[model samples]
Target chain A: MIILTAAPHMAVWGKWLGDALGTNAAGAPAGNAVFGIFLSLLVYLIGQWLFKVGKGFFLFQPLFVGMVLGIFILFLMAKVFGTTTAEFYKSAYKPGGDIIFWFLNPATIAFAIPLYRRNDIVKRFWLEITLSLIIGLVVSLFFIYGAARLLGLNDIGIASMLPQAATTAIAMPIAAATGGNAAITAMACILNAVIIYALGGWLVKFFRLNNDPIGAGLGLGTAGHTVGSAKALQLGSIQESMASIAVVIISIVVDIVVPPFAAFMGLK
Target chain B: MASQDKVPQTETTEEKPSPIIVQMAIFAAVLFVSSLISPLFPPSFPVPTPVIGLIILYFLLASHIVKLRNVEKFGDFMISLIAFLFVPSGIQLAASLDILKAQGIQIVSVVLIATIVMLVVVAYTTAGMIWIRKHVFHRSVDVKS
Candidate 1:
């Protein structure tokens, strides 16, 4: 809404995916959280529609189902536009696939509230949070380095991929500095999010573990960023609070530890 | 009287603090102050502001300076935005495809192993902490003469 209404041109710089996708009839109205919110809502609506009316494959996730419809639209429009369609999304798909990380910053800050509520739980379980972070840091780095070496990865690959589990905006730059792969960093970030979401809760439950807010929040937040904390929150408000705190603590610690540790271990 | 009355009065007294907004303000403050000069009243590493903010909030809640429910509202809001914040990471995947293609198999293998190790280690430690807290921290009340 803001960009579309106030300054339309700024959309090009936001994210490459949106830019490419925009060339058609359906570029984002504006490049902001509101738009993301709308996109998310659209996904939900499509999901419900597919769940109700669609058959076979499309009957599953509405957002994904909607995305398929949008793709078909793209194919149709391409056929209609012919040569002109090729030029349409050039700006959108330009080298970066048309995406920028606009909304993630707020989501990161939003974690503080959960962290706040579970401070005592953290204090009570300080040992657990600290230990979990230290162990996670050591283990993640060690395995990444050891596996890389055994697989005969070059120094650059080892360095770059080491910090992918941290946040992207921060990790991309770090990967660049260390001669690591930024793309790998990106994959690691997403992969880590997936891991955190899937296992973060069950792992805790599996152990029938006890945690206060800080310990739980710190553990999840640091290991997986915002997504990790989100999983922690599902455990309860107490875990959410601690996990938020942990995300910050762990991001900083891992940020420091990852490069040095990787270089030390990988000998790059 | 003071403890009971004060607790009830405060609980009933005011409009609930919007946890999300308040936390945002605090996060901004932490980010800013951290950039300039972060004080270490409580021990920490790398970024001191988060720890300081964590401790300050902790004190406020524990000492009854702030209500838990109010704090909870803010905490829950952060959890809601987790996936949205991570969308950027997903976007970066396109950028990584080149690197991934070049070293895809090797890199992914390492990542897989690392992730598994982290999950196991953290889980083990967490379970241990729970064990200690339950058994060591609590004294049995049973008395037999």
Candidate 2:
């Protein structure tokens, strides 16, 4: 059949394309930084396009889709190169991944614009906002500590979860500094954002938060970071601004408070 | 009073975004200063450089030292790409499959329960405070358009 004949040709084409992109026949690392950047950008674009095509389905969230697709492609490349995914990532993907990752710092600084633009609202409600965040932070720390301990996690696990509410850029460093695994912290941060983005609307309705944009925004931003802010933006302009405020304030509070909290909890 | 009077005039004249190159330069300068200042803090309570940069940039914008128009376009562009910027770090999960294989269920459960509880607690506490202020204090806490 024509289909049967084309399958082998397709496989050959894939290998040839992979080889040309830097994977060699000897099964060595790709050693191509540009390929990593290109793959990230291309996969993200595909994910964005698919999100649009899917009519804004939650599961089709661009970040989630792009990550899954990107990982799957990397897994395939690792197989073709006869190496582990971790090795392939370090040798090939990391060079370019690090480049993209560097932008996160500046991107975080860009948050200042929104904070400044909404300064009036922030000023008017500063007390309310700060108090809510502090209360939330205190409760969250205790909950994380108690839950982790009750579940028999070690100090490292407790330490990592302590900073889980902060954005990854801030959370990872705090986790590492407090003797926790940065990778685990990052996973927790991303998972929190994904969970909030997926269930935020339902949570709002269930909690009767539809009328409280400020509360909704603060909760979303404090718990979910940037993705939560994106969801806040969908709710309204006020929600978006409040979410941004929460993101900034929560990060600062977490930076200042998490270390001592971890130490007080007897975490190394 | 004279400086205060000049604010509106300058705002009126410079309505358009500054050149992209100028915006980049401002960001570079702020980030450079942030990196220099970051190490001064004690190692035990490390403040990330970006957080310092964020505080610096906020002060700059607040004082009108850096006009909103100077960085608005580029800032928005950067923020929009935040989720994209995080993809690399997220992909690092590939390297941690071993840990995931061992304690993944516990980790997931802990994160799931804690996040939900935190969200509910934060939202209600905030909303309750706002409601009390509006109803009890009779303050005009209406959302501004």
Candidate 3:
């Protein structure tokens, strides 16, 4: 929640960045996806050149720069040419965006691949994953509700806010069910990534970690999605796999959990 | 270099698969079949057909029912399609301009707070489990040892 605690300034910047990128895109013929990929490659190359490093930091990535470039590309597409193919890019992307239901079928099945790869991991810790998901989801909502009360954002706002801790694909459904705007969920996704990057080091120190890698990965993935997965991957291959698994599992879990919890609260 | 190449000409050669196109066709055929049968998984199952197709494909891959290298091209095609599925959905924010403007700040603030809270708590809980493992669980093991 450190991000929320320090949000006003970031929102200002996020909106401004989104607007500026959108404005810049108004004139380009390059579609957002192609542009996003090239721009991301350019940033990584720039990061490499700036550090005079070879393949190192390209590997040393949390992918925030690349994701920002994705957002920036979208902003440009939307602001600059919201009229043409720009509109199609938003909905046609398969799993997470417009054709979202496309993901539901596949994500659950993709779980089977991980299940195949980590049969032993699943056998040992499937229960742990389940238990942690429930406990984490509950604690997350409780804290969010409590914070909303403290901030005077009202019960409906608190209920809408509760799902924000999950991935955008997962959170948006819950928010839409509870009357929250999906755009905010997208903004929240980017903002959450930024906040975690900025404060992740401090949180690790505050927790006085004894090099507990899975804990780090799960924590990061449950909240941060690919950004955190990339971070965990940088920590080590084992951590990366676990974090990736956690991101998928946790998002799916939230997809099932958060909306029902809101329903129980009678938020809608 | 010509002499080096000739040494292999005298050696036994390994048989290779016909072509990537053949493998891809096989893979796509598998996907098409699985998608057709996925609904047969019954009401108890929650996942849809295409992913079920992937699972069946993965098994065929992992169990040596199919060679990994053979399916690489087809697998890459499907996975790439899976990843970018969100670009189009993100643009809906623009389409819903009036709706968003009406609730923008409220939605942003609620989501912002929830996102941060979720991260910190999940982090803390994870850290807590490790702490318990080290102190309570590991200490008991240490005493037994």
Best candidate, lDDT-wise? 2
Query: For candidate 1 chain A, which ten residues in a row score worst on lDDT?
Result: A88-97
Once model 1 is optimally superposed onto the true structure by TM-score, how far is the C-alpha of residue A198 displaced, in angstroms? 4.9
Candidate 2 lDDT for residue A37: 85
Candidate 1 accuracy as TM-score? 0.59
lDDT tens digits by residue: candidate 3, A1-268 = 2222233455555445434333223333323234334444454445335434544333223233433344455455434433333342333221133233344344433333444555455445555555666677788877666666666665445555665555555566556656665555555665566565556556656764326666666777776666667666666765566566676567656655776676676665
Chain A TM-score values, per prediction: 0.57, 0.83, 0.60
Give the better candidate number (2 or 3) by TM-score.
Answer: 2
Residues B98-118 of candidate 3 have per-residue lDDT tens digits of 544565566556555665566
lDDT of 2 by residue, A190-245 (tens): 78887888888788788887578899889989888887888888889888888889
Q: How would you order the candidates by DockQ, starting with the best? A: 2, 1, 3
Candidate 1 C-alpha error for residue B143, in Å:
24
lDDT of 1 at A226: 64
- TM-scores for every candidate against the unseen true structure: 0.59, 0.86, 0.58
What would the per-residue lDDT of candidate 2 be over residues B29-79, giving only the tens digit for each residue?
999999999999887888988889999999999998999989989899999
Query: Positional deviation of A215 in candidate 1, in angstroms?
Result: 9.8
Off by over 4 Å in 3: A1-111, A149-160, A165-167, A209-211, B1-84, B96-113, B127-145
Question: lDDT for each of the candidates?
Answer: 0.53, 0.81, 0.53
- Who wins the TM-score comparison? 2
Candidate 1, chain A: TM-score against the reference: 0.57
